[model samples]
Each structure stands twice: as structure tokens, then as C-alpha cells.
Target: MAATMPAPAASGHNGRMLSTYPLLSSQIAFGLILAVGLYLFISERLRVDVTAMLILLALVLTGVLDSKQALSGFASEPAIIVAAVFVISGALAATGISERLGAWIGRAAGVHEWRTIAVVMPAVALLAAFTHHVMVTAMMLPLLLRHARDRQLPASRLLMPMSLAASLGTTLTLFSAPAFLLASDMLQRAGTDGLGIFSITPIGIALVLVGTSYMLGARWLLPKRSGTHGDDDYLRLDRYRTELLVVKDGRWTTRPLSELHKALGARFRLLGWLRDGVRRDDLTATSPLLAGDVLLVEASADELLSLHDDPGLDLNAIVRFNDTVSGEGAPQLVQAVVAPGSEFIGRSIRELDFARQFHAVIAGLWRREGDMADRLSDARLREGDLLVLYGRPSRFSDLAAHHGFLMLVPFAGEAKRRVHAPLALLILGVTILAAATEWLSAPLAFLMGAVAMVSTRCVDIQQAYRGIDVRIFVMIAGVIPLGIAMEQTGTADLLARGLSHMVAGWPALPILLVMFTAAALLTQVMSDAATTVLLGPVAISLARTLDLPPTPFVVCTALGAVVAFLTPIGHHGNLLILGPGQYRFGDFLRIGLPLTVVIALVSAWMARWLWLGGPLLPLSG
Candidate 1:
């Protein structure tokens, strides 16, 4: 009876039995929470950050982690670094430094998509190697869109490679990706020295070279689908009509249309003039305007919208105007997309009182299939439907941040904020220097830069506040505890032991490859940083169990975490480009899967060479 009884229980960490469920309770709860969190994250119904908060709440409530553990992520160094980096990026964007660089690159790469990628990707990769990839995407997006519009190239041809390049660039520097920080922290806590600032530079450079060369083939590989509008499309005056009555004491009363043109630089055609209900066809640049003159103007929607900023030159008394004039201010045109889970999804625009609530009129509607019918009032807004909005520019800006819609077009005046560019650049330089020299830690250095940006007025406090993507911060903070739970629950060791058992007799190089492959695959379902944090310790444990060096495995995990190219949800950069690129879900799989394979193979070899001292596998003795 004693011999037939179950064998003695194996030991878990802290002298607990491995077979006992109470010790494994935390692991079970964490796994379920992760599963539920992933479902919500991929559902596209709840916002990503909302899902993150739910995960955090679950961790605390399930007793898998205490309240302090749940809230500790908010104070983590990675979270601080991410938030501070956002403000620094905002300062660059506010001061037009990014715009200037984009413009210069656009001009240099003129008219050729191939030439543009060759120039833009390398430059973006270099910049991304230093800054966060998301910031690099933010700065590069407007410029690329403008360049595509000017050149008539499809956005599909540019965006995928650009996004991919940004992801690759993160491998170059320690501070470039949040995953690296997590890996470094894990390594340090595991009794190993953390990675140096430039430790991964060699692997990063290799990946960039491979990625850029492959991206040059995008001219043929990428789709040439086009949806960007040209100047003529906006210039269709029949679609947008408005009337203006001149004030008797206005500045334009005695001036000719030519003088008004020279003064305001507004490109509008004079259809005719109305004086006491008498129509006159004599309208030209040299045509004189009189008091109480009514001008029938034929101008593009953008031209009509640009009138908002020129309050001094035009005394406009609107008569029966349907658009471009609101009680708050002159209405401007911008683009907004109906976001997932929007209330307007199934309802027609006419029923929603969209103009009253949003303070904007939909001038036109664009769907992925094509433009909706001209009767936009009756059209139902769907997720991903792009609506051309006409309203006060300030209101339009606010509407962009509303949960119901995602703003696709930026305000025109943003480019004009170039006067503060020098200060923004100085802050960027000092932040980089401080981090490099260890004068302050990476997070503190960036925080100082962010503070300087606000204090020096490179970016106002409000803009700085708006620039910080709370979703990203919350996501990072929230998911970090899940990683901690994995270790605390002995889940990392359990998983690592299982993996080691499977690959027990495998050659060293193949084991490293397996580690990278697993890490890369896991990133598709969750964030890279979260995957890195959870799996970093597992990789170290697996290496120890296999009697191999842990550095190679850790390095493999870090490099693999950043190669999240298999799915759109794999990286925030990919998500940012999804709507603008007009990409279907498979778009990423088509371009990214191959890229992932190439990058993983090359990266694996490089890791083996650098950390293992060669690419060969040891004999399975």
C-alpha cells in the first residue's frame, strides 16, 4: 500500500509542494486574467487602456497580487520613461522640428516612392534608435502622408515598411524600447549585470541593414491602393457653397479683389457680387468692392475654412450659410474617423444631431469600400468610416480626442509653430546626453527634458498634457503587475521547467532559436514589454536548467520581443498606421510574417554569434 501510494511531492519555491493547488492558485488566476485580458484587448470593443485597467483590477481582486503590487506598476521606471518620452516627443511636434525634418526629407526624395523609402526609412530608423518608436511614427506619419499626397503614391506602399523599420530600430539601443528596460531590470535582479547602453547596437545595425534592403522591394510587394484626395477634389465649389455680406466699415470696402488677394492670400473665385438684390457678373482680382457688397464666392472647402484665422481682413456677415460659420468661430475642415464601439455606428447622421453634439458638419463621408452616397445626412457611420468635418478648428481639435471618433487630419496651424524649434532640439540633446552619461537615469533625464519643454514654453502645459498618451502609460503600468504575478506565483519557473523538459537534449543553438520563436509568438497576443518582463526570467531559468549561458537566452528574448511584426495588434506603431494605411487585418500578416521570419532568423544568428561566440550548435552528448 505504501509503495502504491503517490510518490513524495516535489518541492516548489518557498518549501511548498509543487502538486498543491493553493501554491498554484496564483498562477491559475493570473493565467485566466491574462486570457480574459487578451480577449478584451483583441475585441476592438473596449479601449486598450480600459482593458488594461480591468486586468489590473482583476489582479488585485483575485488575490493573485495585493493592492500595492497592483498599483506599483504606475510608479515603475518603465512607466515614467514612457510618459516622459511622450512629453519630449510632444515638444518636438509642438515646435515643428519633426515637420521640418519631414519636409526636408520629402523635398529630397521628391516624386519617387522608392527614393522616398530609401531616404525616409534610414533616417527614421536612426531617429527611432534613440527615441521611442511611437514618437518616431507620430513625427513621420504627417510628413509621409503629405508626401504621398503630393506624389500621388499610395499610402500602402509607404506605411507598412515605415512602421516595420521603426520596430527594427528599437533593437539598436537600450532606451529605444520599453522591453529592453524590462529585460535589463530582470537580468539585474537575477544576479547578472544589466545590458549596457550600446550593448545591442551591433544586432540592431544588422537588423536595420536587412530590413532596409527588404523594404526597397516594397514598390512591388505593397499594394498601390489610393484614397488620398487631390486639390481638385477639395476645389469642387458646387459641393461647398456659402454667401458673405460685406460690412460697411470693413477693411475690404475700398480695396479691389486683387488687393484683398495680396493681403489675405486666400485662393477663392468671385462668382459674382450682389448689391441691393441686383446681380453683377463683373468680378475679378481688380474688381472693386463697395460697402454692403455681397460676394458670391466659389472656393475650395479648405479655402473657406482658412478664413477663420483672418479675422482682421474680412468683415463677413453670413447670410443663409450652411457651413464654415459657427457662433463660436469660423468653421474649419478636418478629417475624423468613426472609432470602434462608437454610438454612431448603426445610426444615420441625420438622427444623431451630430452637428449639435459634435459642433461639426459632415461635408463628406469616405468608407473603406469607397465614398458613401452624396446624401451624407442619411448615411450610417460605421467603424473606420472617415468623415470630413467642417467646424470651428478648436472644436474640431477637441472632437479628435473624443472616444467616438479618431481625428485623421491635424490642424493646419500646427506646422507654423516652428519658432520654438531650437529650444526643443536643445532639450532633446540634453536629455540624450544626460541619459548617455548617466548624469541621471534614463527616466529622470527624459522627465527633466519634459519639464524643460513646459517651463521654457517650447510646449505649453496643456499641449504637454495632451501629448502624453495615457492609454500607453496605463497599459504599461497595468500589464507590468501581471509579469510580477508570473514570477511571484512560481509560474515562470513552472513554464520554464516544462520548456526545458521538452528541449532537454536539443542543441544549444536550436534551444536559443526555440526561445526566440516562443517569445516572438507570445508578443502577438500581448504587449512586447509585458512579454519581455514575464518571459525574461523564464529564459534565464531555462538556460540554467539546460546548463547553457543565460545571456544568450536573455538577449534572444529582448531581440525577439521587439520583432512583433506578425499582427497589427502586436505593436502600437502598427495600430497607429492601420486606418491611414487602409489595411485589412491580413495586411500585416502578408507583409509582416515574412519580415518577422527574416528578422528572427538573422537576429537569432546574431545573438548566437555575439553571446554564444558562434552560430554552431553544440553536440547533444
Candidate 2:
């Protein structure tokens, strides 16, 4: 029944009339309102996913798009591509490919910062240009974190640069990001030919060259944190001194240590025995403890707290007399920085109900430039601020994972289940084959890959859904209709006519540069795909008016849309690193501005030279 539904056509102006009338006026207005709404809601309180879904619902309700058309984006090729990319990335991560790659690069390049940056940045960039940057970030972040920790190199220096490289790299190939696919689809719908998979490679390679050069040079300009040596530096826990206590029921309270150890081995360890307050060094599993006996423990502060709450044991009297006792039974404490893209972003401790909600006591808050707040719950949490909380170990880990917060301390647990390398490679190969052979559409191929991952138990269905960013999916769906509405309303043509008149006498090169720069700048403020869809058609029209080849203009628009490197707000990858890198807004401006200029200049030159034949002037009327 769903498949039988009629395909919806755009109402109002047709393509021919759009060129003459006020084209895409409705679309522009709708897009602006939608964008503002998204920004406000996302900034204030609502989850991005919720906001996106609401927009989609509005579109369907308003008849801007039919239910089928509204849901089309979910089944679109780009969406599938993104989903498949996530799976491949997960498989690659599970197989430890990224870690092995980092280790190899580290060994080959030695410890010199520049050499390491050169080797790792290019490798990551190349991979990112061909796949999803999110996957690249997810796979590489942990590896780089571990590597930096191991080598005593400041993670602050590496994370941002690496994230930047991934963003830049995705600009190199048409299939590199979902934005490109969206652009390609828009172009096709606008009566322009779709771009080839590698059509943008020339300009993309140029951007990468210029961008990577800037990153390598900017490494010295970055701040270096003091502790960089591997896990030991971040995870040292000497402050925590744990001890155990036996339960005394006042009657029939004799139990052998062997029985307790066997029963609780998964949760606790009995280090030594105490009988009548005398310590016994030779305590074995079989040692018996009477009602008044105690057990000395050396475990994490979190572990000790967990045992304190166990129903079968009594730790109250023992904790009172233990020399390790701190304030009111609260154990050791440590400070940790909140990572970027963490669930804690835009959340207040009071809002999160830190104490009552998560059962943790807030101790202190630290920010880079702000004065320290006396109370943790009173401070408004921001990305990169360090938090000091008192809680059990398992509870902290749960909090970190639940909130997408990073553990500043080494994760002390068994590694998660991972997919085998060969199997993952096979799935990736099949996906590529499907895309290349056109045997299946890109979306279907990716969807199939996601299904394969789940069916094989390489990753669970729950994880597959989690792997896809539902917020991004909703944003794409809501925005895609706006593009269609733009085409339907004749706004795109009006904008193109205005631009053509403004650049009437300019050489093709400057006109092309202006269009590209406009797109690149707008991308910093809007979604890249939205920017491309709204602007690509206008760029194409401007080129046509000049009697210049449209290919160059299209390439420029696509390239510019993806090269949003000058600000954290420009791209998600940049935002992903903002917290972890401990970077300030100024840091992005300092490094990204120069990089953006270089990419813009190089991309324009490449488009002019390779496609436009030395910047042809507009045809005289």
C-alpha cells in the first residue's frame, strides 16, 4: 500500500515560470523560519532529534510535502549511504584497525610532533574523504586518545587537528559526505546533470593540500597540556584506599572467607582478614570471620562505596573506625574534563539533577576562563569544563556513557564485543561493489549493509539505530522539502537573476569565486547540505547567464559547501572536538581563518584552470 501511493508533485510555479517569476520565495521564507526555529529550540532545551522530527511533521501537516515525500528522505540514497558508513566504521573500529594504524604510524614516524602529524593527518584525511567523517571521528578519537596517553603527548594538540583533517578530507570526494549526495540530488532535480563520483576531486584535492599544510604549521601554535603519557597519567588512583567489612547479625554470624570470596569474586576482593581488630597477613579464602571481624581492602573509591550499600554486608561500623575515612563516608575524589559532543552539552547540573538523579555528589567545577563556582550544581556546565563528582566507579562509568561524556580516567572494564576484521572488510567490499555496479542504489546498499551487520550479530539492531544520528536524519528530511519548495516557488531563479546582474561585467573567475565564497560562508552558519541545495542552483544559473560551463560552477558550489573549516559552528566534526581539545572560539578563528582563505583561493584557481578555461566573461546582450 505504501509503495502504491502516488508520487507528489510540487504545487504552484513550474520550472519554466520559476525562471521568470519570484522563484523559491516560499521556500526561502520557509527555510529561514525553519532554520531559526531549529536554532532556537536546539540552543534552548529540546534534543536535536526531537526538533527535526517536529519540522518533518510540520511539513507533512502543511502540505508542503505529502507523507510519502516527507518520508522519502529516510529512504533516500544519501541517508542509506550515511547509515552504511556508520556500520563499516563500527566494524573497522571493532577490529582495532584504527588503533593498529595509529601504532604503526607512531612507530614509523617516531615521536617528533610534526612527523606524526604529517603521517596521521593525511592517512585519516584520505580515509575520511572516501567514507563518513563521523565514523572516522568515532574510530580515530579513541585511538588518538590512547596514543596520546601512551606517548605523553598532549591530546589537546592532536584532537582538533585530526578532527579538522577529517572535515577537510570529506570535501575531496562527492561520496565523502551526505551533503555532497544531497547537492548531487538537488542538481539532478534542477535539470542539471548529476556530478560524477569524482567530479569534485580536483578542487577537493587542492583544498586538502592547503588545509593540511595549515594544520601542520599550526601545531606549534596550540597549547600543550602537562600530562600526555599513556593511561597511567590520567588514571592514577593512589588517593583511593578501599577496605571491606563483614556483616554481624549478632547471632549465627560466622562465615568463612572462602565462601564469601567465591560468591562475590565478580564484585569484590578480600585483601586481608581482621579478627578482634588484629590484622592477619596470612588471610586465605578459607579464613573464618566471626561477628566482630573486619576485612582490609585496596580498591577504587567507587568500588568501596558500592560495597558499602550491599544488603548482605555491613560496612558502617568498619568505615567509622577505618583510618581512610574522609567526610561523611565519601571516598576519594578526582577532576575530569567534559568532552565535546557529550550528552552534557547545554545541560545544567541542577537540570540534570546531578545528586538526586544520578546519585552523585558534585564537588567542584573548573572552566578555562571563568571564575570557579563555589557549588558544582550552581555552575552552568559548558564544553571543556572539568567536573569533580563523588560517586562509585560503576556509577561514574554509567553516567559517562549515558551522557556521552568521556572518561578522563582510563576505562577500567572489559573491552566491548567487536566484529572480526575479515568479515567487516567483506561487508565493506560488498557495499562498495553495490555502489559502484549500481546493482543497488547507494541507500539500499547501505541499508543492506546495516541489516547484514545486525543479522550477523556483528552489531545489534539497537546499536545500528543508535549508530545513525537521528537528529541529522530528521534535519535532512525537513530541509530537503525546503529545497523542493524553493524550486517550486521561483525564488532560486530570482536570486540567480539578482546575482547575474550584480556580476554582469565581471570576469567569470571572480563571479565564480564570489559564488563559491558565499556558499562557503553560508555553510558556516547553516547546514552544508541546505546551503548547497539553496545555493547550487543559483550558481549554476549565474554560470549559464555568462555562457560559461556549468560544470565548473557546480564543482565550486559543492566544494565550497563542504569546506566549512573556519568555525566550530561550521561543521559537526569541529564541534565534536571543541570539548575534548579544550579549545576556545578564538582557536578556531586563528587557525581556521587562514585555512579557509587558502582553500578558497586554491579551489577557485583549480575550477578556473581545469574547467572554466581562464574565466570567460558574460556574453554581451
Following a full C-alpha superposition, what root-mean-square deviation does model 2 have from the true structure? 14.3
State candidate 2's TM-score: 0.63
Strongest candidate by lDDT: 1
Query: Which stretches of model 2 miss by more than 4 angstroms?
Result: 1-69, 145-154, 224-419, 437-440, 548-551, 609-621
Model 1 compared with the native: what TM-score? 0.67
Q: Over the full model, what C-alpha lDDT does candidate 2 score relative to the true structure? A: 0.63
- By summed lDDT, which 10 consecutive residues of candidate 2 come out lowest? 410-419
In candidate 1, where is summed lDDT lowest over 10 consecutive residues?
312-321
Please give the CA lDDT of all the candidate structures: 0.72, 0.63
Best candidate (score: TM-score): 1
